[model samples]
Target chain A: MRRVLGVVGLLLLWEGLAAWGLLNPLYAPPPHQVLLTLYGLFQSGEILPHLQATFTAALLGLFWGVLLGGSLGLLAAFSPLFADMLEPIMLLLNAIPRVILAPLFVIWLGIGLASKVALSLVLVSVLLFFAVYGGVRNVDPRLVERVETLGGGRLWLLKEVYLPSLAAWVLSSLKVAVGFAFTGAVVGEFVAASRGLGYLLSFAQSTYNAKLSLALITLIVLFVLLLFFLFDRLERHLLRWRPRGRAESQA
Target chain B: MLRVENLTLGYGGVPVLEGVSLGVGEGEFVSLVGPSGSGKSTLLRAVAGLVRPRAGAIHRAFPPEALGFLFQEDALLPWRTARENAALGLRIRGWPKAKALEEAEAWLLRLGLQGLGDRYPHELSGGQRKRVALAQVLALRPRLLLMDEPFSSLDAILRTGVTRDLLRLVEGEGIAVLLVTHDLEEALALSDRVYLLSQGPRARIAKEYAVPFSRPRDPVGVRSDPRFGPLLRRLWQDLEEVALCAAS
Candidate 1:
């Protein structure tokens, strides 16, 4: 209740600042204008297709990130030889800025959603890969020994110890990478797209509609926040065994 | 029966123990004792296959399923409930979840961990977690057990009770135990025979003593025994010499 009230108060303060002309209405439009624009977009249903395009790309990217990154990370952890073999190559790939590849992705994938999804995959895979890789590598050696001594083979040890230990790490990195995934989608759209939030932002920028641009920025921020909230809830629900440290604040 | 002949273990160019040979007859209880850095834990680890010995021949009558190890730390899976943690070994051995959990529950009950099977590791007390850890290995019903200072972290009251409980179980089951400890009293109380490890890049057995106490032993009785005090003093003297040699 208090958190909701605090947010409301901040929104009212922004409204008051805009009404008094303390803030420039051209660049920082009032909250009501943004809210009205959102409502207009909703009624017209013009945002749906673009929203769908962006979300579809993000979902595909997340799927690949979780699947391939997780497997490769666990594999690397199990074999130091594999780690040595692939680390240099992975580092070389990671060193190349993913955003810089948008033009190349556009050239290769065309101006379609494929390029955007590909760009998002590049972002999410690196983050997710490191998270799972570190998680797998950090399992307690003593615990591994305990399992091995009980007649468990390598397969058993990996299933019981490595995978479960990596769960928390995977979830945490996924939350962080979701934002990057969205950014990747937007950047890809900015490079070349007929749809999505990035295209809308670009369109507004080109037309010099500062209010619309600000409104679109606000919508993207809201989308990111919603994604974070959803993940936070998912983490709590799936990992109930994990202790909640700041219960008072969370509550 | 198990035999570790001329076992040499170390990392890279450094050797922790060398020319170390030991044998455990069927159902025998042996304890390895030494001062800090004496490689007692290293020896147990070598037997458990956690440490690859640089050179040695370790012959075991049974396969991996017949050997269990209790680490110094509980090492319980943080994400798993107590029952799941206890059952992990069985699950790894290819048992179904239901059967594995049933076996884990039985061991948990045997270890007086009834009604706490669903609790996660962080929800358990230190003593309770240790008990769960013990049950995890015991659930496998291994013929040979390698324990690396399993009760070193407990308070005296808890330690005494746990030690007594563990001894009773091992004796009843007729399992072989190779325990490592720095506590002379613990080594004296539980072991059928005790070997003192000397420290070095090539540490060797400095002294071997056959503990004369009978099974179902108590600390009070062992402390009162006339033989106990002199044995302690002798082991202490031997350990001091080993430490001096190691320092040199």
Candidate 2:
């Protein structure tokens, strides 16, 4: 309740500032203008195709990113040889802002859904890989030994210990992964694309349409927040065993 | 039956135990008591096959799968309920989930964790969690149990309560136990024999006492026995000397 009010208060403050011309209306339009444009875009259904395009790309990338990153993390944790081979590569990838690959992906995969999905996948995969990788490595040795002494083989260790431990790390990372997926999709679309929220954003920027740009940005924020809320519910359900306040707040 | 012959254990390059030989006969309860950092746990872990013996042989009449180890740290999986954590071993051994959980729930009930099978490890109190861990190890039906101060974390009252159940179940099952502890009364009260280890860097079995307590001993009742005091004092004095020797 308090958080909602804080957001509302900030928007009203922005409205007052921009309407008073203390803030440049050309760059930072009044909150009402952006909100009205968002409503109009939806009412006219002009944003629907772009929304669908970005969402499809983002969701597909999220799915494959989680799968591939989690598997790679497992491989690295279980085998030193793989860790030796993969660590440097991941470090290099992570060293730079992953969004720079948007242009490269566009050139290779073409200015289509493939390029956008590829960018999102790479972003999410790197972030999730480290989360799961570190999670497996950091599990208590006593727990591992207890499982072993209890006659749990490698398979049981994976099921009983590794996967459950990974779930918390993965879920927490899934939140950030959500944000990264959108960034990747939008950035890829902004660089080059026939359709997407990012392309609309580029159009708004090219036409010097601050209101339209603000509406698209607002739309993106609203959709990402919606996804974050859904993932939060899923995480709460799955990680119900976690001690209260520690897991979610830390993330 | 188990025999650890001249066992030597170390972490990294530092020797924790040296030439520590110990044995536990079938159904006999043995305790290894020593000062803190005296390598009692090192020996226990070595016997449990977790640590490689630097120079020794551990011969076990039972198979590796028949060994149960209870650690000082709560080894229960945090995400799992009491019954699920207890059932882990059973599930690992090819028991179906339903059958495993049924057996685990039965064990939990026996350990006085009645109807709390669905509670997570964090939900349970420290003593309750210990009982669940005990149930987890015991549910495996291990013929030989290696416990590293499993009840040392509990208060005396909670310790006695859990020890009482542990004693009853271990004796009833005819399972052999090798308990590692620093608590003199706990050592003297619970086991048929107590082995004291010297101070560390290169620790070894310094003394072994035959605790003359008879079969099916009550952990609390044994403390009140006439001989419990004298032996405890004697061991305390010996431990003081060991601590002094290490200090020097």
Candidate 3:
């Protein structure tokens, strides 16, 4: 309740700032005008086609990220040789600012949603891989040894022991990765292509329609919040066994 | 029968025990007693096949798959409930989940852990966790059980309860046991024979005493028996010299 109040207060403060001329009226429209423009844009269905393109890219990117990241993380956790082999390449790729690759992806994939999806996948997969790999590596060896001495084989160890221990870590990384999911999509749109929230922002910029741009930014914020809320619920359900106030046990 | 013929144990290149030979006949309860770092645990680990014996063969009537080990630490999986942790050994031994859990519940009930199955390890007290660990091993019904200081961590009151529970299980199951402990009282309470190690990087068994106490002993009552204190004192006196040597 207090957190919600704090957010509402911030929005009112932003509106007052524009009303008082503390921020430029053209650049930072009043909240009322932004909401009105958002309503008009939605009524005209101006957001749909671009939203479909962006949503498709984000969803596909999320799928690729989870699949590739889960496999890579498992490999890294179970095989030191594989981790060592991939270390340098992963480091080099991660070192490059991913946002810079947006234009390159556009050039390569020809300014379609594929470029956006590719960018999102690259950023999210790396994050997920490390999160899950570290989580699995950090499992208590005493527990593993107990399982082993009791006659649990390697496959059993992976399925029952390692996977459960990694659950909380993987989900936390997913929460963080979801935010990056949107960033990847938007950056890909900003660098090139004809559709997405980023394209809508660009359209408002060219027309000097600050109200519409602010409204679009508000819409993106809500979209990210919705994604976060959904994942938070997922995290809660999956880790319900964990001690409350800490990472719950997935087992 | 479990036989250790001139067994030696080491980690990497550092030898902990050398030429240590012992045997636990079927259904025998033997205690390996010594000062700290006396390689008692190394011997237990060797029997469990967790630590490779550097220079001898260990032959067991049953395969390694049929062995059970209870560590000094509980080693219960924190992520699992007490029942689940207790049932883990049976599950790993290829028992179906339902049967494993049923067997686990029986053991837990026998160990005085009824109504605590749903609790995780962290939720239980130290003594409760140890009981759960004991239940875990017993659930597997191993022909040979290797325990390393299984009751060394408990408070005196808790230790008494755990000791009583352990003695009862060891006798009831008709399983062979090789236990390592620094506590002479514990060895006297649980074992048919007590072997004291000399101590150090190459600790050797210095003395073996066959406990004279009869079966189904009460821990406190056994201690009160006229012979118990003197026997314990005599063993400690002999161990003092070895303790000093190992310390230096």
Highest TM-score against the true fold, candidate:
3
lDDT of candidate 2 over B95-200, digit per residue (tens): 9989999999999999999989999888899999999999888998999998988877899789889999999999999999999888888889889999988889
- Ranking of all candidate structures by their lDDT, best first: 2, 3, 1
DockQ of 2: 0.83
Q: Residue A246 deviation, candidate 1, in Å?
A: 8.2
Cα TM-score per model = 0.90, 0.93, 0.94
Best by lDDT: 2
The sequence of per-residue lDDT tens digits that candidate 3 reaches over residues B1-248 is: 98788887887776888888888888899999888887887788878877777798998888776688889778787678899888888887788999999989999999999999999877899999999998998888888888887777888999998888887887888888888888888888778899999876888888989899988778778888889889999899989978887778
For candidate 1 chain B, which ten residues in a row score worst on lDDT? B214-223
Model 2 residue A23 lDDT? 95
lDDT of 3 by residue, A202-237 (tens): 888889988888898888889888988898898887
State the local distance difference test value for candidate 3: 0.85
Chain B global fold similarity (TM-score) for predicted model 3 against the true chain B: 0.93
**Chain A TM-score for each of the predictions:** 0.90, 0.95, 0.93
TM-score of structure candidate 3: 0.94
lDDT per residue (tens digit) for residues B1-248 in model 1: 99989988888787888889888889888989877876888888778877788897899998767888887788887778999999988887779999999999999998989999999888998889998988988888889999988988889988887887788789889999999988888888788889988877688888888888887667556778888889888888888888888788
